[model samples]
Target: SFHHYETPEDIRSKTMEWIEDFHADTERNATLWTMEKLSKHDGSDPENYPAHVCVMEFVVQVGADTRTFPSWKGHCVTRRNLVHFRGLSIDKNDIRWNEDGFRPLPDLACCLEKEKEYLLQNLETLLHRGGRIVARLKEHLEDQDQSRYTLP
Candidate 1:
């Protein structure tokens, strides 16, 4: 899970704490082991078949206070790309334990594209808001200068 903060420093501390807690949790101890295995098997040609299929999960939380401020704006982005098993050959392909061995699915590409689009839309909105705030601030500064200084 990702939690946003008004300042980057605050979020950095929280992120470190979360990492430490995750490492200490016994129930979640296997998370890093699984990730390492996945990394080693990813894109490996002629794989005998991974013992277990892995599904990566992500969570994000955007703080309310940081959402509106121009200077303190923050974003939480997650990207997931589908895994394709084009080279791996398997015998007796069957779904067990609610998990299927690595195999290419036609719909996976479409789903990934949709997710990418959603993230892009969110980033675009943030940029738009930042631009608007900057323009308003510039106008305010100009107005202040006009009122404070007379023609000399």
Candidate 2:
């Protein structure tokens, strides 16, 4: 069997589309969807709880054991991609648990592409919201800067 992964550009474009859509909802957008780039350490920090959605690939495998519930020895190649978001930092040691904020992306390439065409048509609206967007982005960067150093 063969699998196909979207190019980084495609993935990024789709992610942006989802974010832009989320931003369109004025009431909901107030919550702030920070972080444009993906991170391995994402969702692991207490300060950054509820990180917005991002895509990542995970490989799962099960041991072959007939007596146990439908076990297999080899890696499970299917359904490797996921839409990760809304993470919580409960236990620092358990990364899997901390980053469990996800939903299986059946088609990784299309997960966030549903409104691409529609968003393209409404680009003007998004552009008009630039002020809010810029403010939020500035806040995000400033937060990063402040968090990098200890004031004490």
Candidate 3:
């Protein structure tokens, strides 16, 4: 979406040209557009029905450059966790958004709460398993004669 600033036409054109040039080196098809047709909602669709994002991967060619991104998820970080903890491939600065800034999803609290409870519930088992493994390692180390080990 282009911003509707009440600026002169020439200025706007130059600004847009500059912006496009700045992003010219970036990969093509890096931006995802909303496609309503041949979507996931239909029963005949092989992909998940009523999917918000396209799970399918696609390639787009722009001049001599070729770029690829998933149907819906594309290169943008849409989730709350992704906004904060972008995976290895994503750069925070490159996140796509039409707004002045990005905001994490509003439902992140519930997800965080569930994650906290899950961690709490599994903490004991994890600790117990760690303790057993450490004890076994210590026992094995004790049984081995240190002098018999050779350094590389």
The candidate maximizing TM-score is 2
| Candidate 3 deviation (Cα RMSD) | 25.5
Model 2, 1-152: lDDT tens digits are 23333335654575466557656867645543223322222334424431222212211111112121111111111122111111223233212221442112233234345323322323222233231121132222333323232111
TM-score of 1: 0.21
Candidate 2 — worst ten consecutive residues by lDDT sum?
68-77
Is 2 or 3 the stronger prediction by TM-score?
2
TM-score of each: 0.21, 0.23, 0.17
Candidate 3 lDDT score at position 132? 10
* CA lDDT, every model vs. true structure: 0.28, 0.28, 0.28
Assess candidate 2 and give its lDDT: 0.28
CA shift of 27, model 1, Å: 1.6
- Candidate 1 residues lying further than 4 Å off, grouped into runs, are 1-7, 31-152
Runs of candidate 2 with Cα error greater than 4 angstroms are: 1-7, 32-142, 150-152
